[model samples]
Target: MTRIKNLADLHKIKEEVQSKNRLRSSLDYPEHLVQIKVGMATCGIASGAKETMKYLNDELEQQAIDAVVTKTGCLGYCYAEPTIEVTLPGKEPVVFGYVDKAKVVEIIDVYIKRGEQVEGIIPLNFQTIDD
Candidate 1:
C-alpha cells in the first residue's frame, strides 16, 4: 500500500479502495443490477475465458456500469468454451459462448445497455418439471 501524504493522495486512495469494495459488494449481493458469470473450467480457461472475464470487469468499471461479475465451473459446453451468462434484473439469464473481449463489450453495450440480443446465444435446453 502506498502512503498517503496529502489530501489529493488520500482522496485517490479512498476512491480506489471504494471501487474495489464496491466490486466485491456487488458479487455478494444477489439482487445486483446485472450478474455476469464467466465459465472458468479447464477448457474455458484454455479458450481465453480469463481475458474475457477481465475485459468485462474493466469495461464495466470504465463505463460506470454497476454489475456483478463472477466465475463458475463448466456448463457442460466444452465445445463452446469461454462461455458467459448474463442475468439482468427482471429478465431471464442468457448464456453466450465463445466470448472474446470485443464480444464482451458488445454484450455490455448492445445487450445490457440497449436491451438488444446479440448473436452467439446458447439455447436453453433443460425442461422444467414440477416437483
Candidate 2:
C-alpha cells in the first residue's frame, strides 16, 4: 500500500474512497447482478491472476457495477492462464482468457455495461463428464 505523505494526500485518498462507496451502494438489486469467477490456480497466478483480481475488485466497485466477484480454482484451461468467467444477468457464462486490467475494462464496459461481446473470449470446446 502507498503511504500517505501529508494531509493533502490523505484527503485525496479519502475522497477517492468516498466516491467509490457512493458508486458501490448504487447497485442494490441482487437479481440483476453480474457474476464473475476468477481462476487462481498455479498457472493463473503465474500469468498475473492476482493483479487481475485486484483490478477487478477495485475497478468494479468504483464503477458501481452490480457484480458478484469471487475467486475460483483451475478452470481447466491451463494454457490459457489468468482466466475469468463472467455471467451477465439472465445470460450464459462467458470465459475470457489472458485477463488483465485492459481486458477487465473491456469486459465491464463492453460486455457487462453495454450488453455486447468483447474480445478474449474462450469458447467452450469440451463438455464435462457429468454432461
Highest-TM-score candidate: 2
- The TM-score of predicted model 2 comes to 0.74
Q: Residues 28-117, candidate 1: write the lDDT tens digits.
A: 545457878999999999999999999899999999997888999988888888999998766778999989988988999899999897
Q: Pick the lDDT winner.
A: 1
TM-scores of the candidates are 0.73, 0.74
Candidate lDDT (C-alpha), each: 0.86, 0.85
Off by over 4 Å in 2: 1-30
Candidate 1 overall lDDT versus native: 0.86
Q: How many clashes (backbone N, Cα, C below 3 Å) per candidate?
A: 0, 0
The residue ranges of model 1 lying beyond 4 angstroms of the native Cα positions read 1-32, 128-131
lDDT of 2 at 79: 86
lDDT of 2 by residue, 14-107 (tens): 9997765444434453345677899998889999999999999999999987678889999799888799998875677899998889998888
